[model samples]
Target: MYFLSKELYFPPVDEASFEGVLAIGGDLSIDRLLLAYRNGIFPWFDEDDPILWWSPPERMVVVPSIYKVSKSMRNLLNQNKFSVTFNQNFREVILGCQQIERPGQNGTWLSDDFVASYTKLHEMGIAKSVEVWQNDELVGGLYGIDLGHIFCGESMFSKVPNASKIAFVTLIKYLKEHNYKLLDCQVHNDHLEKLGAIEISRETFMKVLKSEEINFSSSIQQHGR
Candidate 1:
């Protein structure tokens, strides 16, 4: 296990252990987080534990063009019972994610520091959120980092059945319209698998992440520093 210092640097992703832990103890500064995502790494640690960075052997990602929308979900979309919006109430959306319970997890990793850091990212327009509204009430939503050509999804929540699904599909539509190339789900879960997220080797993931064909400079400029 590698330990991180105040310096804004990360070990090569190939250095990660079989379990995908690459490094530990780095501060969650905006610059560090940006660099981490650019290099196919992310932080995931409990509240009392030192920050842990990971570059998993297998990454779960969604290609926007192939995102699955079930027939029932399609009907729900057609019904228009829920309204979806982007970058609206990001704090609320993240808070919702923080509070929602998940199976097998005793608690959430969205600690206060994590929230503050990502909120700053949102202020800079690098982090974004999808809000689902029903009768003007906030119901379901998701939030993540937007790296121009790709979206690094962090978390989501739904107060009603399939509400988060609705938010996710809506995000896919928006990504498709904007020509976004990928949605980084980080790891696998039944929920994401049903939505077309697939596992790919870390090498394959890094190839896309470091590809010369993808340019993040424009995205940074568009979103502002």
Candidate 2:
């Protein structure tokens, strides 16, 4: 374990020692947050707790071209009853996600500080959101940091059944259209696995991250255009 300081570069993170926890304690300042995303690390901790950075041993990810859409989902897509949009209402989406109660979890980890930090990232054009709407009401959505061709998803929520799934599918479709290679799910979950997310060794994930060519600022500008 290493203690983070303003001057120290994040130590060499080992896949085998993921449970060892590389570093702890740091402000989610723009510089540190940017560095963390570039190196496949992210903050996840309770509100009263110090910032805990983690890079799990097995990275869960979905390649846009290969995501699985079930028969029911296909029908939903055909109906087109719900609409999807990008960066439409980021604040609403984040608040919705934060309010959702996860099974077995007593409270949300999406603290006020977390919201403010990510909102700042969104302003910088690095964090993007996908919103799912039915008629005119925002129902479900997801948000993440856009690292060139990779989207490191943070969290998602659904107020109605299949709403989150709709947002996720729409996100993949948009990524496919725009040439994104990978959607980093970050951790494993049975629900995500059903949508074709798979666990790969952290080393493999890091290799992909290193080799992928990305121009973040240009991508943001293009999206704005």
Best by TM-score: 1
Clashes of each: 0, 0
lDDT of model 1, residue 82: 91
Local accuracy of candidate 2 as per-residue lDDT tens digits, 55-134: 88877887776566789889988998898999989999999999997888988889988899999999999999999999
The ten-residue window of minimal lDDT in model 1 covers 216-225
List the candidates' TM-scores in order. Answer: 0.91, 0.89
Candidate that scores best on lDDT? 1
Clashing pairs for predicted structure model 2, backbone only? none
TM-score of 2: 0.89
Per-candidate RMSD, Å: 6.6, 7.0
- Give the deviation of candidate 1 from the true structure as CA RMSD: 6.6
Across 82-196, the per-residue lDDT of candidate 1 in tens digits comes to 9898898999999999988988888888998899999999999999999999999999999999989889999999998878998888888888888877889998888888776
Worst 10 residues of 2 by lDDT: 216-225
